[model samples]
Target: MPLTDAKARNAKPKNNQFKLFDTDGLFLLVSPAGGKWWRFKYRLGGKEKLISLGTYPEVSLAQARARRDEARGQVADGIDPSQARKALKAARVQNESTFEVVAREWHTKFTPTWTPGHAVTIKSRLEFNVFPWIGERPVNEIKAPELLMVLRRIESRGAFETAHRIRSICGQVFRYAVATGRAERDPAADLRGALPPVKPKHHSAITDPEKVAGLLRAIDSYQGSLVTKCALRLAPYLFVRPGELRQMEWAQINLEAGEWNIPAEKMKTRQPHLVPLAHQTLEILRELHPLTGTGKYVFPNPRTSKRPMSNNAVLAALRRMGFEKEEMTGHGFRAMART
Candidate 1:
């Protein structure tokens, strides 16, 4: 007889396990420990076989019958229902392993070796440029043309350099996917020379000694935050990269030793650098000391002491001093020193 909801729910466990048979090979197996399991029994290739449907209360009577009917239909069509279930599960797993998933895994694994700023830039590039386009696709199935379409989108904006950077970053991600056995090959590799090369633009500087001296006098008499004015003054003297100069920590400066030590992670070459302090530079530092000496950064943000000054602070100061973008920039200090 076919089981009903009442019969199935009211069924009790016995000292030994027993089955309550329903029609169409569906039954409820009540175990000795009061556990109820719904199971399906069928014959295939002239041999009887059985498979689990679910649990009693969880599967319920009607749901168990539906599942049993579905499985019997598969057996009638000469397909092993268990094997079909396994194949469906494998396909689902494959669908979940997407390019974004693998790329994020790779990013997390290698982020420890990169500087914090570089790590943020890498993540930002992928999130803004790559992820929205191809992130949901399975890593193993992504093709070369698909990746090129993504890069071409970046190129369409006249950002040739940014396009090239995204391509390199994608290449690294694909290589990581390959090394981890998720992808077959890097599609980015097939895109060699596919984008226009970026032209090198030099920072503009006032190379004439008299103009340089004039710029210095302007900085000295500049009307700005004392911290920004100090940074402007030190830029020409130290000639460190603008980033390194802005991110300088008070702990790295040795006023007594007359030097500022920049750690390797902060430098572009990833090597530690030492800048010897001149007497004038030392005097400027000593004068600025009392104001910002208590903070972690030598030039902390005016709004918040936790972070260093904005990267635009120096450039904006130069702009305020009547220097056009084409004439001079914060990076111009480096070129000015070199000349």
Candidate 2:
């Protein structure tokens, strides 16, 4: 006889396991240990076969019957329900392994070898440019044209350089996916010369000694944030990268030793660098020490002492002193020193 909800729930376990038959080959298997399991029994290819539906209380009487009817329908159509279930599970797993997932995994794995600033830049680029477009697509299924469309979107904004960078980053991600068995091949590899080449840009510098002197005179006369003013003063003296200069920490400087020790993590070459302080540089440092000596950075942000000054602080100071971008820039100090 077919089982009902009351019969299934109230049924007690016997000394041995037994089955309570329900309609359409569905039944409740009450074990000797008081465990109630729902199962389906059916015939296929003129032989009997059985499959598990679920457990009691979890898969109640009506739900078990529904599942049984579904499985029986599969048999009528000559499709084995077991194989279909496996295929569905595999599809779900593949869908969950997306481009964003694999790319982020690759990033996390290699971030330890990269500088903090470089790592942050790469992550920000991927999140802002790549993820929103193709992140959800399965890594294995992404095609070359699809990736080109993503790069073309970046190019549409006149950011030719940034577009090329995004393409390179995507190529790295696709290569990682291939090595890790998530993708068959890198679609980014097929996009060779797909974007315009970025022109090499040089920082504009005033190499003439007379103009250099004029720039120095202008910096001395300028009145701005004291931190910015000090940074501007040190730019000509140190001629370090603007980033390296701005991020200088109090701990890295020694007034008595007349030296600044920059760590490897902050350097572009990933090597420790030492900058010997000149007498003029020492004097500037001493004069500014009273105001920011207790802070972490030599040039702390004017609004927040916890952070370094803006990367553009020196550039903005030059602009305020009437220097055009083509005439001079924060990075121009390096070139000016070489000349």
Candidate 3:
């Protein structure tokens, strides 16, 4: 029978591999591989045509019968199933662009236009966070809610700023995809006003000049590592971000000139900064010279000179001094000096 409606239960398996029947002038074969397939044999425009329907039991006998009827109707209308499947496949290939492939293509095209450091920043964030999440999803199919889910994960970790930056990069990739006709619209668009606005957590700032005098006075008495002491002294005088401060290389500083040159690669504003060192700042550097003078970084990790110290080194030093994160961070010195 072309349509077998029997249900199997506690029964022995059939060894017969070929189960065949005819429906609507089409021969249907159910192979031992469990493939319930359709084949149409006819002269199409004076050429013989053979078409496969699909696999079974997924395509049951009843479904195959319906498809067989549909194919006969298509043949009557002078349409070919094989040719139609080819067109459908081509359309799917055109519409579907994997996130990683499109992202890298966009990155390759746009990185040339960005400043070197900014380009690295964009790439690092994507590789570590974004790629692992949506890299396999089709670019056109990524919804704003899905994007929100990714950003919210970062936000939950208290990385509010990083969440914002990643959101920006995702937006950039989508824009590139749109320009190249890989995607229809930038789902990350209008997300600027859509995502949560970043608010730097309120920290305990030293507002009183007297308190600043006391904090500086207390800093002088701390018996910490020379690297940390120097880091503390320089934090107030140089007032660079923690990353810039930690990544400070010997190649960028000139102790003789009483100047520290922050490289373009390390700065938040994407430009090198020049700090005219106070005598006190120079003294701290001079004291630490014998310890780290041969290394790549002035404050390299105690365990490695090729790599910078962990970002938390200075902050951890502060915590040991009974200062909580909200009270005074290494970067808080900048906020304090400004006030």
Candidate 4:
């Protein structure tokens, strides 16, 4: 059926469905739910296939027919229409201007001068904090207030440190946008005093000595699991951050050598760290081996069965031991050890 304007209007929905066929290798498929769509059914690589021609009357029959001919030409050229369409879609996505694009470009330009940790920190801040807010908006179109809104959100959570970091990230992104001619100037420059400062007490440590002694005793007293006992006993002996402790790979620890070599990438410094396994640390490792030595990570999370132990897994054990947050933290052992 050659669908003219009159035919289109005359086409009726039956039981909430309609069909048009026998033109431009297309059958207009109408959903029982009230959406009229065009589909071209054809043979490709000896397999019958269907390609959507979008919806009509927004996509008129004439437009559907035009698209059918284009797809046919692609088939003649030995290119699958689906793949061709996918390639075209990808090209269009690449061509579209977006905030992610500008931010990445900004990241590329500035990351070379930054330490690896700084680069990672900046990227993480942008991905979580800034990109969601204005990464999709045109850099030139972003207002000061809009940028402030992003930082204020971080401030609201009392993550003032992260908020300041986002401010720096925004400044870098906007500068990159300006250099690349995507934006006019950095709107983040004048917003220094816009957010609350991070408090001084959040130095990422456990504060009380008496509580820590109690927590240590609880770890020693823990009889629920040998792995937990080893981890708790060795906590202070290998006073690396909790993350460094948990990400301990089997290959990284040498029981005979009495050392756990934390690779730089895993360490906060991104430099290889030598954990001098005191006799106490090695003794705990020996016991931990019978339980988890068969796995790659020294302490794989029992619940996940794949990843390193949960970051809070050890901390949670402390919680179960009835330790208060201020009394002891996973990092508090470091403070106690360092002091």
TM-score of each: 0.69, 0.68, 0.58, 0.56
Predicted structure with the largest TM-score when compared to the true one: 1
Cα lDDT over the full model 3: 0.75
Ranking by TM-score: 1, 2, 3, 4
Candidate 2 off by > 4 Å: 1-43, 46-78, 107-133, 217-226, 256-259, 263-280, 337-339
Task: Give the per-residue lDDT of model 2 (tens digit) for 140-236.
Answer: 9999999999999999999889888888899999999889888889898898888888898999999899999999999998899788888899999
Per-model C-alpha lDDT, please?
0.90, 0.90, 0.75, 0.76
Tens-digit lDDT track for model 4 on 102-137? 888778876655557778878888898878877777
Off by over 4 Å in 3: 1-96, 107-167, 191-199, 202-204, 268-270, 304-306
lDDT computed for candidate 1: 0.90
| Weakest 10 consecutive residues of candidate 2 by summed lDDT | 110-119
Report the C-alpha lDDT of model 3 over 1-339, residue by residue, as the tens digit. Answer: 343445311112355554355555566554554445556665569888877776656665566677777777777899887787799887776545778778888888866566677778888888888888988888878989888888888888888889998888898889888887878888887567765787777556565788777767767777877787788777778877787888888888788898888766566665667988888877878788888988888899988788988888887887787777777877787787677
Residue range with the least summed lDDT across 10 consecutive positions in model 4: 198-207
